[model samples]
Target: MPPQPSLSFTLPSIHDNTKLDCRIYQPYHSNPSNPSIPPYSSSSDPSWPRHAAVVAHPYAPLGGSYDDPVVHLVASTLLDLGFVVATFNFRGASSSSGRTSWTSKPERADYMSVTGFLVYYMHYLTAPQNHARSIEEDNNSPPILLFAGYSYGAMVTLQLPPIDSFLSHFASPATHTAFADIRLRAQHLAEEQSTMSADPASPRKSLGMRFGGDEDLSPRSRGKHRAHSPDPEEKIRRGVKDILSRSKFIHRRHHSPSADRGTERNIEVPCLENVDNLIRFRPAYLLVSPPLGFVTNLATMSFSNLWPKKRKDGRTKNLEDYTKREESEVETEAKLTANPTLVIYGDHDSFLSIRKMRDWATKLSNVEGSRFRYVEVLTAGHFWIEHGVSQELREAVYSFSAGLVKS
Candidate 1:
């Protein structure tokens, strides 16, 4: 059977920004109206925009959704602790609106939009109950905004500036320049992609000459024709096209703007191939700059990556791209809060090896000092909670998260 999709709903947000559609995967019993509710439910409330923690789904376009097991585990855990836990799709995320692109500045805006809207909606529907307050008055409310995510979502949560401070700063026209750097970087990348494509030796450009860019690569008739020449010698051809496309896709996803700005400097990944040629890699420190710049740099590098174009030939000058990706990953991971964080990676995960994941996490923990957490599930390929994970694993998740939620 196919998987069930998440439930979708629209909420009006602050500043009259676009009304956002979010996929809200709520716990079955959090609402008391349903007795069949499990232990992790607070279902009795009839209030609108229930008191809950918001789970920001990881890289939604990359098969990560509100229903992803890691996200579900987190959301479900919070729900059982008596919080109305809901995970929403970021715009361009699965079922969410807008074009599919990971622009950090814009995505962060969307996240705050969700936070603002939820706070306002809850206040409007249930007066005298304020769920959000200026950071100065953060403790004044209960069931406060708890934004959580795995990989990219983690970055989003970490990168969120103090909303009240940001709003206050915005009242003055002088501070608008804070957003300019990201805009400039994006423009630079766009220009770079176009210029790089112009190089005559580029394999893509070379292919364009023979096939006629109009035949496949050109904006017109793009994706209209297959590149494989179906001649009798077809068996002689290899699967280069397919493999190259997949590789390109991963690199492209990292180029998204959403994953590249603000407090999004802290990136959470299941695993990393930490050793290369037996040299262990260290996570880079991101505290070298002001919070905004530090976060922006970390964010830019976390979710997006520059593609390393390696032809079947022995040459590889994409060293610049490789260096950039490494720096980005290290800084983001290293910049995590001193409060211990749990980094979980599956052994069987195709993305990277357990050793690599461990090495990166170890180095990151070193940066954050004693306040670091790491977890690895063996025989699990990027998803232990699926076939490989047992009930014990689920219980462990509950036990761990339960410590964070107050009854």
Candidate 2:
């Protein structure tokens, strides 16, 4: 089948105020009268797909982009399942602004900005103000948002800021100045990290493994590796400590403006109830071959560890501060446990070994609710380049999404 037509646009990253290239892949709708040509709609059409998705590409340094094969595969799968998919280039990748950071902290702004744009777009389309003919004629409801990321992108997605908090902050006037401050802090981090040789500039060098279709591992091998793997709890604890230490610097720079300035600004900004209405759409997250070690380490870390501290007196806090506080009150795993989430990886995955994948499954399985599940495709590598593996991944994701409706 031919690829669906995608609308291209640029979104300013909240981190550095840099313009990031983005594309929205609208689901295919048949043109009955003119079968030879593809159907097109400039506004919301009832016949068009309802749910929307924002998919993050894999690691940028390793040739990952909005155009990556896996990204397209997932986007296409979601589109086939009746969704409008949005994909974008992360910082330092393609034409996006600023260099990539070692951790997922900086990408928080990028993810939140893209999410905010979609939420606001949906709100506008559904609002009575939009005069688009198709929308007025059809009166279709808005799309539900889904956030899916692969590999390094998954790491960033796992650490995404709280949605309500992000929306509140985005709706505030201090957003620009806050973003400017984040940009400066990011620039400083980029300068500091540039001197270090720790960052991996590329994916694994097993060219034959990645492309030759000969590196697939067996389920037995995966089981043996899992049996021999070290206890995940200690490693998780150590990782959390290290991540907290590293994230301290990032949090210190996220300070909000004074209470008086914020109060004065809040009067001009939309009310809390209004902001909530604007962002009524919530998102379900899917992680494909996420590096378990990285995800688990940061997933449980509190927002207080990465967000600026507020004074004891409630007056010192603003919407952003309160949002951060609200997020800090809950554990990341607890939040995901409350929502629909899926984690998929391969027995022979390059990014996350089978043993680590098992570890994540075990850890997340302990969550109170059965809101999380995982699928392991046998003989498939991290990238799912082998024949039929991508399809299996798609089916897994689709099934998970379908299950979401049932729950």
Candidate 3:
């Protein structure tokens, strides 16, 4: 294959009627420009694609999305290597809901939803279903599903906790209520900020002044600055005013808490949603995905150290910062050692670490005495450059996935 094949579509993510724009690449068919993409029989019964590999993007707050060249490259790489690839944005990222937060519950749900969607589309056709057909292949199909992502995306994947225990977390009144509240807050926050900024009397400058510090910024940027100098209320008023003037801009650009874009909201809140999530994961692939730096901080910070510790009187110990976390540092045993998992951590991954990535592959995920795969691409940073990863690096991805398919 020249590269592999890939395709995009809008699929239902949040609800049935509302669709999330998604791109599903054909399994391992990289060369879209090729004379022949994989031939699909037009019969009402077409073939079922591979029942594996849901690909997610890195941190959306930091410009990561299903469409990023880096994440898609991996999707295409896996597609070429013979796996069904599904890529999408976190709810607030490209097009999915709520806000992009460290505890990416909706995002993870987005990933899980792909598995159900692919399986339904491909298999439902055989009996009383849609036009999708099962691809002619051997019968010993395994229900094995593979989930993976890069950087922020990887952290999202590792968040996949056990189904049973995880469900209870959602069922708890407090956690469920908190999640609903968070979702509502995100929506209103997006709206309130927008409405406040649209006033005709709003200042002439862009709110870039609030996030602004670098005087070296271009004139165009400075022109957009909401306040060149500020009073605190004026700054807030200007930013809220700016938000109103541009809803779409704010929805896509604004990050949470700080309300600034490009910030990664990976810190787990002590809220029911996050504490439950941290408590439930396999803990094996915790720091597996590469570009080591990107993962390590998230992993190390993942400790109870990030959360506020409590004392015997049921009062929580005070942290220097008002921000508090709920989870106490707890011992976690590895869960994924039994499932063969392949992880790819790019050396350039800034959010997470590569050493942790290799360690994950060789130890935790693979350590369960399961089949393991590792790739350290040379001359390649986090995202494989458009120029292309070095041939050696390219081979590692393809070769490893190919072996994965065979094994």
Candidate 4:
């Protein structure tokens, strides 16, 4: 069977309205002709597993983009395991519009926007009317969401708000806003894809094939290719405007006097309510070559409290206060320990010492009821360039994802 094509789109950053390039790959089920491929379909089978993943690349200033080799490796591995995978360019990376921030707050918001889109997309795609009934009557399992990252990206992922907090922004977004538009767009595209998946002969005019050269091409080469081909960015901008206009129309109709009089009620309420119910998910995390020590501090620009400071009363405050994390941070840590998480790093990493990484892993693993696990590859560097390191990395990712699906 031919490889499934990816759907490329642009989403606005909640921080500054910058356009971020994004792609989503659908999972492929095996064909009868090919027995080697596994049989799994999130679209057709109501009982089939429903899983989605969002992978963030390394730092932008260090030449990171959605096309990074490691990012692609992780995405492909997840895709093979029946995951609907998503990858995106952070601000100032590749075709995305903006400059990298000194502090990583804006970048964090960028990740949040993409994550929100995927959540709603999967919700609408999997929650058919029959599926909804089965969920309530048969007590079917909820979907799974995995938030994975590499290097500097992992550092940012670790600092993200809790799952419920991250999803609350979409529960009741205002009309005509970016959040509202994202919800609408996700529903529209998901419905379209679901229809196509149901009918195998349907023509996929919008989806483009993903070639090996496209995935491995350098950023410079990609720019040159974009210069020659028809522009997708402009087409995406027009689509965004259409969705925004549609949202405005829906808002007006929903607020009209007839709507309140029980004559012209909103049509989307039923679907949105079902999506709300389907929002319950088992969260998972995957961190590959996560940065540590000074590299982490540099990536997050968090040097302010690195040293002790004198108190206003002329007494030096205890340094322990600095180590005390905020409530959100504490909540994030709790979620990680409570759920399945996989951390993979190399012993010969250049950016961080092995001792520091080992200590960090040991501390997290020692926590009571911690499901966190780590794998240290021998002679592997930060980039996983050692001879057999990439294979080992892929195996670890596959094992972690398979376990989640089976459980």
Candidate 5:
């Protein structure tokens, strides 16, 4: 048979009604009817057992977008590694709508929207009610989801704290207050634009908060909140942890010898039964060249610089507390030391000082389990424009991904 095609489509900017350009690179397969192959019916319905990886581009204001060569390279490599890859242009980048913001708030919404789309698509293809038809395929397991990025995109990737966080957020409509905030922000921005415009007759456009094509993201029914309940964010975090525990039980039960193996592909059916844990999507993250100094050190120093008068009085105590906190955090970090992360940089990177990069690398290397690796490409700079440098970078990424498969 002929080759299956890659899919391109649009999703509305979660921050506004503008359509964002997105593409899905279909997995390459020699046997379409193989029991392991995920069946692709529509862009929304992909049925099969395969993992997915989404690549976010670099800083948009500096001309980054889905079309960036680095982004395409990573997507292509992931596809070769048997991952269903997705890449998209962020707001005001290339063909996407709205201008990129300095604070990166709007870009976060764009990332969340893309992630929401991927989760919905997974549910559509794998869930019983949305399945096109069932086949007597092998006992194929669900695909693992992976997230990878370069530079600024890598920064976004690192901000996520493990895949379990997503599993919690997606479990139910009641837990998605953050999404509701996005919709409200979108509406408020639209109203502000309307007031400033000269023409009043022009109709206002609104993007509906829909998940899985038909179901509204907003909670359909209301329940009374307990007077002693924690804040909304904390509640959602707890909800996700609880859902994962229950989902794990369902997973063990479905895998029992007496259960129907073929039918267990609809395993998420149990998760959907509980109104809160309705979505069954999770992704692991691979971040490259995240700016540690920019995110952490600068903030720590900003206060000291702003209030020099108070610095001397508090310096000793502050240093003591900071050291204690770091020591405690290191103890916790021991638990995740086995979770490997690879950090690659050019020796002459323009965006990072040699001292800062070296210090970061040293710290990563000292982690107990040694799951962190630091590699410096000789004489190369920030963007890797030097001759053959891009290829070297690609090899490093591909090696890291291949290692994940083996481990």
Candidate 6:
């Protein structure tokens, strides 16, 4: 089958103000008239098929982006299985702004921003129109969010905080904040999409036309604005309003050349709501060729022993801080274990030895009540470029996703 159509847009990183290029692909069978493809759920049906997936590419410094073939393969598989798949560039990748960081914290925040946006977008699109009725009443089943990554991206995915903790950051963001801005953007786009789904022949505006202006601004110009612009909050609000106004004009001016002009539908900027009740997702995980050992540590600059020695008076404070960090890590690990997790690697992998990978996988799978699982292809390598390994990878992903749908 041919590739499915996708919506191209940019999302701001909560870490910095840099924009990350992103795309969201709806399933091929979303159209009502496409009888060749088996229908999973009606596009207009606001209740079922609330499954969404985010696929992350490999290392950014090594030329990985949303267009990576491995990323494409996984995303395509999920899309075929009725998932609204999302793929995005990390900072320093492709047209996204900013340089990659050594500590990896900023990258983790970037991932969080995208995930949060997807969660809100899904909620808005699937939510019932009746505000009085509970959203859960329309759909008895909760939404499923699959977080999948490859190579360095997989490592970053594993280190992410639990779903609840991550969603808490966006629960009730203050007005004029970056989190608030993200929620606004997601709602606007979701409204546009819902409209299009109702009338498939509508003339759609590109995200660039809708959210223009800043894309042409140089990084130096942005830096200057940050340095000199007082009232940055007001500036952000004005920018959003200006973009919407420009989009309205563009839509009217380019309405039609051969047919009678009609009144354009007013674009409603959705009001922000307390999203805590709207977001209730069951999380699943998929890791493809996740790196391990010393190389991973060096790339992330994670040296535990590099901390400065504490004074005798501060020893207790230092110990308390360490304990808190350890507990946070343990909490994240426990969440991963409780979810449906799958790690796929190759025995002939180049970056990490088979022995170390086997040991890590075995240890995780052996945890009490753990749902973690793994698949190690005998002759495949890190890239899965071997003759038949790509097929194996696809099959494994298909089976995992099929299980999610059935359950």
lDDT of 6: 0.73
What Cα-based lDDT does every candidate model obtain? 0.41, 0.59, 0.44, 0.73, 0.53, 0.73
TM-score for each of the candidates: 0.47, 0.62, 0.53, 0.78, 0.57, 0.77
Better of 3 and 4 by lDDT: 4
Residue lDDT tens for model 3, 1-407: 22322333333343222334454444422454453434221112124333346667767777777766656556656655555556666666765544654545566666655544443333321222221122222233343345666766766665565444443433222312333222222223223323323343435212211211222347787566535545433343454445334432111122245457665554332222221111111111312243334343453343445677787877664553223322311112133444445565556655445555555556654343555445655556655552456454556555655655565
For model 6 the TM-score comes to 0.77
lDDT of 4 by residue, 332-387 (tens): 66777888999999889897778988987888888999998999988889888889
Instruction: State the weakest 10-residue window (summed lDDT) of model 1.
Output: 279-288
**Model 6: CA > 4 A from native:** 1-5, 30-43, 46-48, 129-139, 203-272, 302-329
* Backbone clash tally (model 3): 47
Ranking by TM-score: 4, 6, 2, 5, 3, 1
Candidate 4 deviates by what RMSD? 7.3
Better of 5 and 6 by TM-score: 6
Q: Which sections of candidate 3 miss by over 4 Å?
A: 1-19, 27-39, 42-49, 128-139, 162-335, 346-361, 365-368, 386-390
Q: Model 1 clash tally? A: 23
What's the CA RMSD for each of the models? 20.9, 17.5, 15.6, 7.3, 16.3, 12.3
Model 4: pairs clashing at backbone N, Cα or C within 3 Å = none
- Given candidate 2, what's the lDDT at residue 94? 80
The TM-score leader among the candidates is: 4
On residues 127-198, what C-alpha lDDT tens digit does candidate 1 reach at each position? 222223223134432333445566556656656654454433222211113222112221222232233333
